[model samples]
Target: MPALDNDTVSKYLERYAEPESTFGARLRRHTDHILVIPAQDEAATLLEGIYPALNAVSVRGERTLCIVVVNATDEARTIVHTNNDHLLQTLTALGPTTPLHTQDETPCWYAEAKGFDLVLVDRNSLGCRLPRGQGVGLARKIGCDIALASLRSGSSRAQLIHMSDCDVQLPSDYFDITVPMSSAAVIYRFHHEPCGNHAIDEAHARYEAYLRYYVLGLRHAGSPYAFHTIGSCIATIPTAYAGVRGVPKRQAGEDFYLLNKLAKLGRIHTARSSPITIRARSSLRVPFGTGRATHDIARNIDAYRIYAPRIFDLLKAWVAALGALDDALPARAYGAVYERASETLDPLDLDRLSQALLTIDAPKALSEAAAHSSLARVRRKWAHDWFDGFRTLKLVHALRDTGLVDIPWQLAITESSFCRSSPTDTGTALIRDRDAFETCRRLARLEERP
Candidate 1:
């Protein structure tokens, strides 16, 4: 799961005050959104996930808008004092003040204490304070619910509200990346570090299985359906959030469902151009696949309990600990870093790109990513083939350079004359030669050595 508590974040806060430690590129303008975070008995992971986020958002005393929600069940103060050595050590170093919600009082007190421009939430909030609301959902509905409530109640409908699991360490540039959402659609998606091959492979296989069944099922005919969003990174327009009031609720996931609603309202898009590494680790108590990261140790429901969390957990904590700044950090010193921290976890843009992908003609930039990715694959295959002496050559033929090709080929002038001086038919025959095919055929023989 997420690593560090307030203590760990505190230890890292010094980096912000001293004059720009690492995170880069930020705004010097007045705070724009009233960041709200909903936390629960996640004391074990809070310091690692949110402590830095507060500092990163506040940017020291320079920016003053921040709201945090902690659910200690009926006991709020317990949520505030869950600080232990690890958490304290981190918090002491970070430099922001966290005013917690107290028992017997409503959660709305944050509005008075922080004067937040907007409220952001990460969990532990069915808005028990504002009016009448109470519930729980993650894997799918966690981020979706936060987006709905935060955007619906704000005075002007906040420009943006971010949500994240307490178990994740965010990127330092999280806000920087999402800042653009003030103007358009942005959905944040993390670049996950490699998770356990077994579980991930299993889950991936299951997803594919589902896709196959979905395609094969007699649900509808001639309707194209290719849109998906994960709860971890979804950003919708404030107006859009308000518009989709009656979206269906899933006991486990809300990502795709939320995205479907938003797509109807406006557009859906992915955030950062650069991928932020996300950790994937989980407590055994929380089931995988179905989606809930955490649940009651004794009695719980809704956990897929399929996907392993080890990779995500490690990556999230490392990202938060290193690039994710605390609310305690000075904006003047770590503004850029602060921006990076927020963007790391939450996305700022996705509408345009996501829609384009759905439409099948992605932007030139995304096209390049895929094209270059293919080239990279070719290079890798070539390297493997050459080194293994043709033993590893399944894709080797795909790696051949067009420079060696003839007959109206692009990129060169001196046709077969200056090159191999062979006929076009002969050239094709050489490439598709029986011996060449045999060499590659033998290469695919390499099996996993268990």
Candidate 2:
């Protein structure tokens, strides 16, 4: 594993680490990579689908440890608890197990597996169930925290804490990519596999297209924080993970927030190898994500709409203007920057841009950025950092809410230069054209070059 600061790792684990489980010195050593999967009510899927897929992963000569955190909230349904019990039991029966650690009534065990060592963390038992609001965020934190602690304890040589869900099939080359030591994290390319159900497949196509379209939009706007924030598609560096104070304990949007913070630390490299095959299925496991998106879209495909392309256009102007802020006079930096940004927009778009900027308080923010640093380059960096991923998303929403209402997904796809280089069919016909929409999704991925 790449070298990490012992101090940072120790500090983070000491203060921000999860309290449920502990990784003692007896934990297996010489691990080359660690993959963390948070499984909740996924017994059959874990045993039949995910397990076989993991065994097929080809990481030669490397001792990989797969840490699966079997978790459920105290308020979870009886079926969830039953599934958790079955999963834990089946895993225990797989091979002879060695006790690792137990704290707060949470039991962690280690067992030899086909292609990787297994560390099964039980957070779903009667006394150890997670609290209602903690959800997957805490589960992920528990698993990743264990991975971090294990790596810090000199038992594991892995630098990256690979994260995925029970619903995805990892690529065989998942652990084979070589990332620069300077990289804060790397996001694996992912494609949601069709379940052969017509309605679900159609919904998956639109939802995946929407995801790609948004990322492509950000890339076109010259945003550095344009990567997808799916927890299943990310692998974070040890030091960078600790630097961000570990993952947030949010019930939803945790992945988005985690990546948003990680992006500020260093480059989030995009892996160009085989894409992870994610199973497209409906679920209400969390508030929102691929599952929820597909579920809703399948029910009301026509009602689903994407942001207007004009919003991205305005965003592009704003990003460009922020980049040019360094050239402005210090005395009237905010005014000069705003004027330059406004000059790029047409008269009708100017008001919308001005209103959106006002909503986000861009003028005061830019002034403060200038006040923070006198050097042109430093001030420019400050501006960009200040307008990070979360704020960029907020800006998009502000523009949408102020005046640029969302257009139909069909119109957005056909009109967005970021999504398509040429115009496509119009109206309801395009919406029903799954092949055409899938083609657009592929194009969007190409345009989102790493």
Candidate 3:
């Protein structure tokens, strides 16, 4: 569910100073495409990392809108506020400002790049406001809403809002890629930038390895929702954006939740373009992400170990049993599956899942599978819905709580089949055996192409 209300969203969107009537004129009557970047104290990368990359887009006939939401949490101190001020100054200096939209005191300025029109939306401008704790998610939703509004008001038929981050360098042909109409969202290829610092670089490598390992483990468990959820790697259809009620307003994991919802709507494709380069660094922006993982791992390398491989085995068994859900395998039998998946859960708690399955009528609710006049359809649908990524993660935690230990980075690497390296490896040694991580990432790329 969307973490915010329609009234609240409308209010936040109303902060855009440009009237709908003026969107056409500002877009040069050609706002057929848009890119939304949520900036929070990213002045260092905004000019060097993102701007020049955006300048390289050579797509013609499609009017492009680049919306930069310059914002910070309401509780932000001087440093954050100052960085935003500098970012705004840098954007303003990009070219002569042609004002388009304004909310309260924050005016959205129009600046021209080579072939794209830049709309700088400064949330920190005087009188502009947003609730506390509404971070990048809110910034993204606001920018997308503006794009949607502009599309609805103009002659353009733009249907996609490409979401990117300031820390990543976009490909020169970023805009040239097209998403399938049947799909609701697309995740583009991304690789973390390697800074020269050994400690930082090793931490990032381990963190990314963990990220890929989790997704690949889910794939092994037969999850349909197995995919990366990076905010900078996402693009969405306007209808899908509205269908999910826009991105959630959480301090973190907004991408995960948003993609989770979209996955149910339709296929989430992986784009097969040049990978966008995301800079690796320690950041306190949210409760978790690469930055937080990097910070935690640097402090204690073992603190963020991934789920045990056996958990995936248990998950696979549970998922597979869904198809064999005949009278031979009763609801209680399913509980046994959960018990094997995680020894931590008592028979009673595990039995509850069986009861829940019975209540949902097992695979009987799956109509598409019924077309074959077989129970196989029912089993597949039931297993998919019951064992989504969130539920799968929950099961892993239950195991962790019950003494299913997490392995160190090297062990996780071995378990994830990233490499045949010994679990005793540490630091740079573990990172060096990152072939499995890259392999998993490449396999993930197939999802975009398919």
| Top of the candidates by TM-score | 2
**CA lDDT, every model vs. true structure:** 0.32, 0.80, 0.65
Question: Residue 390 in candidate 1 has what lDDT?
Answer: 19
lDDT of 2: 0.80
lDDT of 2 by residue, 224-244 (tens): 888899999999989999999
Clashing pairs in 2: none
Per lDDT, what order, best first? 2, 3, 1
lDDT per residue as tens, model 3, 112-184: 7556677888787545644687887778776777776665555345556788887788777666566776688
lDDT per residue for candidate 1 within 215-287, as digits (tens), equals 2111111111222244445444544444454223333234445555454434455555333334443333123
Candidate 3 weakest ten by summed lDDT:
1-10
Maximum-lDDT candidate = 2
Instruction: Report how far off residue 181 is in candidate 1 (Å).
Output: 9.6
